[model samples]
Target: MKKRAAFLIGTGCVLIAVSASLAVNNQLESLKAEKSAELLTEAFISRTTVFETSVTEMTNEPVPEIIADNEIRGADEQASAKKPIIIDGQEFIGLLSIPSLGVSLPVNNDISYPLLKMTPCRYFGSVDSDSLIIAAHNYNSHFGKIGMLKPGDRVNFTNAGGLIETYAIAEVLTLPGDAVDEMIKPEGWALTLFTCTYSGTERITVRCVKEERI
Candidate 1:
């Protein structure tokens, strides 16, 4: 009986140590994500400012009538272009903001294991196409609390070209991690944000639709 008690105490100590170590590691990851987010936000803002300045100067210059007409014709195409914003040697597509969650993070142009560690990445589709899907790790500084969002919550995405698209949450549901086809299927959702559940077995999916501007 005494030997069994000692063994039980030893196992308890091991479990406690493992739990503490995991907590520390999680905290460190969150800190890293926060720093990366700050850097990306600054870069995005700088790029937008420069683009706006150039546009202002161009508009100020006198233009030929025919040239002005051509520019007007291509305006829609230019606005829909997904220009890559490079920061720290990584290509970011734009900034994603969830006002209800008070979360804003730069989304990379492509999704991968390494990139997800730094910030959210575009899992599929484009913002202009109205089928954007984003994925990120469940770090507290990332999409950890997205599951708390409700229908009608506001989410915004600012593209590299300085256009901001607003979306309203339409639904929140869980999908199996292997449901890749369903996750990317437009299905009338203008935007979809997803993160792994706390157990890492399923995805917490937030479906959003474009919010009509008054």
Candidate 2:
């Protein structure tokens, strides 16, 4: 009888331990989502301020210089249009927005550890080129839900100078996890957003193309 009581107590302790662990995990996930959302909000506000200010300034100035023949105008145009937003010494290259996902995050050129967690980053290629690639973690509030986006969904990109460009989702792909190099070196995709799949065995890729420019 004593042995039976001890076994029962041990089983109860194991169950309590498991319950506590599950609770902690759930709390962590909730906190992560909240933090991701907060970061995205802050990024949007920051970029909006920069964009508006640049637009106001442009209205008062002469038209920008003409591009020379044979020059790559896409990247150069962006560079000449507006100055970068410096926050805590970090420069945000652009703004990425997807209304369907409720995401508007800053686009930084660098994808360092903590920075990516704060917001999305341009992992490779140029937004000016047809193969721009952006990446972020699959946090609950981050790019985790990008797979829900379907063809014809809209995605907006705002460069540093307040130039807004819109794109329509062309394809949603799940590539092998080991295809990181291939994913970054896109062929003709205008804009690409990627994150890891839930099982970490695949990469979710959302491709978009130019639809409108404002």
Candidate 3:
């Protein structure tokens, strides 16, 4: 009888352990989902909203007929009568807006070297330069929503000249801290957006292919 009792107690202990483990795993999965959502929200507000607003306002600006028809107008662009409009220097008169990312703000030029806090992703800086790269703060309040964003999403940027630019997401990558090349590729004109992923340990990388130049 004693042996049987011992066996029963051992089985009960095993059952309890199994139950606890399952509970823990479920909790972990739930937590990850929550985090992803938070990240998205933060990105939507800071980056996405700002970009969209900038583009919409720029559209109202008069486009130079010379540059409007020609994508690469060296002399005609500068000679055009119309010019990009901006307020406070902080405002971007000509910018593109991406509806998918909830981004409709002005995009400016920024390089990885001598990094600055605010870099606009829209402008190519020099027309001969490579891609239009930009960065934004990755806040936790977003709950990993930005991290959850996948490649192929639509992105837009406009210039003060009322020229609308469009891009399609090419890559969405995450890398360890201090790693910044995949994000800074010297390829053609690729639009790159990056921020911290999950508490800033991993960097979130976004690459986009320039689709339309109007």
Candidate 4:
């Protein structure tokens, strides 16, 4: 009888030990999974942050060499024009960075066909006398995230004098491409962004107002 009792006690202890081990293993696995998810999120945020900084730097850069060609200048003007600072690279036109929506692009050039001939990038920033009309590709690979902008989001670019131009989102409007007349209602200097809507190719335009900045 004593031997039988001893055998039963030993069996109970072994089962308890096995159950405890399994529980610990499961807990460790759960923790590991959570850590992995956290790491992935951090990585994505970091990548976007870096992309924004890079795009902004690109925007702050001088004008593109293609546009700076003095050869076209009336032969005599090129000599005394102060060697027009010439810039090259896609970044010269890059100006805006939307982190929340993972968008960083150069908001340079007018809405004319000739500039589009310069590069296939999203274009904005006024030329001569006009408020900038920003346009981006509706495709997800480009500035499609502009649709995600909300009130208070930021829009940045640089002026002809190499000064950073900043604007804030005051409102978002879902309007037609021809609605261009309605976009200038913002109170301050503004950057009007337009693109095809997510559900359809209909243009989606959002205007951001300029706020105290050099």
For candidate 4, the lDDT comes to 0.50
CA lDDT of every candidate: 0.78, 0.71, 0.49, 0.50
Location of the lowest summed lDDT over 10 successive residues in candidate 1? 54-63
Cα-based lDDT at residue 43, candidate 4: 36
lDDT of 4 at 191: 69
lDDT of 1 by residue, 1-214 (tens): 9999999999999999999999999898889888988788778768763333222212223222322232343566455436778888888887787867778788999889989989999999877688899999999888999999999988877667655567899999999999999899757998999999999999999999998411
- The residue ranges of model 2 lying beyond 4 angstroms of the native Cα positions read 1-44, 47-83
Give a tens-digit lDDT track for model 4, residues 135-209: 655544344567778988766553322334566777777886566456555434456777778655477777777
The 10 consecutive residues of candidate 3 with the worst lDDT sum are 113-122
Root-mean-square deviation of each candidate, in angstroms? 6.8, 6.8, 10.7, 16.3
lDDT of 3 by residue, 109-190 (tens): 3333212223233323332253655655442221124555567666655554434466677777777777656555558646
lDDT digits (tens) for residues 169-204 of candidate 2: 999999997887778665877899999887888989
Worst ten in a row by lDDT for model 4: 81-90
- After TM-score superposition, the amount by which residue 25's alpha carbon in candidate 1 deviates from its true location, in angstroms, is 0.5
TM-score, each model? 0.84, 0.72, 0.51, 0.48
Sort order, TM-score high to low: 1, 2, 3, 4
